[model samples]
Target: MVLSKVGKKINDYATLVMFSHTIFSLSFAVISMMLASKGSPSIHTIFWIIVAFMGARTGANAINRVIDAEIDEKNPRTFMRQLPQRMLKKKEVIVFTAVCFLVMVIAAAMLNPLCVMLSPIALFLMIIYSYTKRFTWTCHLVLGITSAAAPVGAWIAVTGEISWVALFMGAANTLWVSGFDIIYGAQDYEFDTINGIHSIPARFGIKNALCFAALFHVVTVILLVFVGILSGELGVIYYIGLGIISILFIMEHRIVSPDNLTNVKIASYGINQIISITFLIFGFVAVIVK
Candidate 1:
């Protein structure tokens, strides 16, 4: 009975890990390759790069959940998580984390020397982001930066060096993620405040925090536009996609208000998913047309 329960718990945790959608990280990598190669990257390169990204993202998220299990237990919104609910053991999480890290290292080694060398640093940032909430409200920004590393790392994987375009993408991702994160944090305002945790919503109240979130997203659009211009790879399809994304962004903000969080789920996951998919499609079209 004990072994069966343990197996079930592991399966549940694994499902959550999969649902975390580290594919978003992989999407950034795909975009980077498209930009760098001006069309398509070799299948071999794409395969190894994706493996590295997935391994790293899974490792990072699992470690984050493990480390924050105590905090999650305290927060109503997160109390149901596997670790917080004691459905999974700490030892199991630790072993899974180590395995994920090993997979990342192996994948990085197969990619290039630069990728291998920087893998540890990238993992460090991902790991550090999990704890930033304990210290500052800037934790959202830290998480943004960590996620932004997807494009930057992917760029390096392709060109094996840093590029201004990659930095631009990183900046866009930074703001995009920070903006949505602010929205997500709104759901935790009461919990955050009661727990003495710092967050934009906890520090500034929802209205002002949401305004800041809008500002960040505006910056995200601007940065992406700037990157497109600099690359000279964008076309009509890209602009159309941008228009849709902008509309979606506006709609995202419109749906959520300080007085009500009814639309929070729609804006955070639903609309954001659309925006990412739009960008990915546009990016692919831009490279193909050029």
Candidate 2:
């Protein structure tokens, strides 16, 4: 009975934080880690990188749920989420967030002094992302920037220094993430606009917002091409993977329309998982073959 109760509680927290969403940024982080190491990083570095990412991402999402609880309550689609439904108390989630942040700091310190020094900045970005939607229509972009830290942080963790390649890859990550996030936010358009929650869909309407997402994704692919070139990994395999990602991107937008978003869940979550996994696999192979 006790074990079942513990399992249920764990599942609740995972749902609260959308634990499966970890793949979105972790894929980019793995890409940079492979690129920075030219194949595979030290086992110790890889361990710490994963730890840091989990800590930071979990904490950020937990806090975001708390901050957005009221808004979630108003959105019919999100009303049953743990925080909005009161399945989890704010204090419990906050404690979880604080512990995750501490874990992030420790993981960074274990990686390197540079990572440790930048840990606070990374934490700030994580915290700030939750607040951006309250005031800015460009919150997707803000989220992109925050999510960029994953890949950039991985590069620094492996290389112990930043480089143009890392920056370019980070930019690509930003655009990719922002593009997808815009798609995801489109589902909340009516509720967001009614509640004064800023979002691209709320600002530009779904069709135009999708167009903007497409543009961002185009730039993302271009920036990725640049990453391969500048990073000296200009292999056909990488381009091939990128081509697949582009197709996935197109497919993502295809499933959702301004008038009908019946496949929003598939577009937002299903295809995105495939994209990230494909990119990470190809990145690792490209690095090895280079």
Candidate 3:
């Protein structure tokens, strides 16, 4: 009976944090790790990196849920989420977030001094992102920057120093995530506007917001191409992966528009997952074959 109750609680927490969404940023982090190490980082490094990512991401999501609970409750589309629906209490989530951050710091300390020192900045970014939507339409960009830390942090974990390739990887992640977030935000446009929550779609209209998303993605692809060229370790396979990604991006954009966003969930989550996994495979192969 006790075990079952524990299992159910774990499931509830996972749902609260959308734990599966960890893949969205994790694949990019691993790709950057491989590139930074030229496919040769120690197993110790890999383990701690994954742990750190999970800790930070889980904590960030938990706190985001807590911070946005009222807004989420008011937004029809999000009213069913765990927090707003009361599947988990606010104090429970707060404790979970605190534990996650502690784990993150411990994992960082196990990795390297630089990672340990930078942990606070990462925590700050994660915490601050939840509040951005209340104040600025650039919230999507803030999210992108926050997500960029994953790849950049992974690179630092492997190399102990920042590099040009790391910056390019971070930039690519920033734009890619920002672009997709804009599309996702389209779903909440009306709610956001009604609640005075700033978002691109609410501020600029859905059609214009989508245009901005496309422009951001275009820059994302270019930045990725630059990452490949500048890394000098990635080549044909990597570019081929980018080709597939570009096609997916086009398909994603085609699926949703001002007139029809019925497929936004499919375009945002489903296609983005495939894109991230594709990059992970091709990126690893590119690093390995070189």
Q: Which candidate wins on TM-score? A: 3
Minimum summed lDDT over a 10-residue window in model 2 is located at: 228-237
Cα distance off (Å), candidate 1, residue 213: 0.8
The sequence of per-residue lDDT tens digits that candidate 3 reaches over residues 126-172 is 99999999899999999999999999999999989999998999989
Looking at model 3, how many pairs of residues clash?
A: 0
Q: Rank the candidates by TM-score, best first.
A: 3, 2, 1
Residue-by-residue lDDT tens digits, candidate 1, 1-290: 99999888767877657555654555566787788767778887788878877888888888999888899999888889888877778888889888988998898888789988988888888789878888799988998888887888888877888899899999888888889889999999999998888899999999999999999999988998888888787787877888899999999999999999988878877888888888898878878987
Cα RMSD (angstroms) for every candidate in the order listed = 2.1, 1.1, 0.9
Estimate the overall C-alpha local distance difference test score of candidate 3: 0.93
Stretches of candidate 2 off by over 4 Å are none
Q: lDDT by residue for model 2 over 1-290, one digit each (tens)?
A: 99999998999999888898899989889989988888868999999999999999999999999888888888899899998778899999999999999999999999999999999899898888888998999899988988999999999999899999889888988988898889989988888988899999999999999899889999999999999889896598989999999999899888888998888888878998999999988888888888
Worst 10 residues of 1 by lDDT: 18-27
TM-scores of the models, in the order given: 0.94, 0.97, 0.98
Give model 3 RMSD, 1 decimal. Answer: 0.9
TM-score of 1: 0.94
Q: In candidate 1, how many Å is residue 219 off? A: 0.6
- Judge candidate 2 at residue 231 and give its lDDT: 88
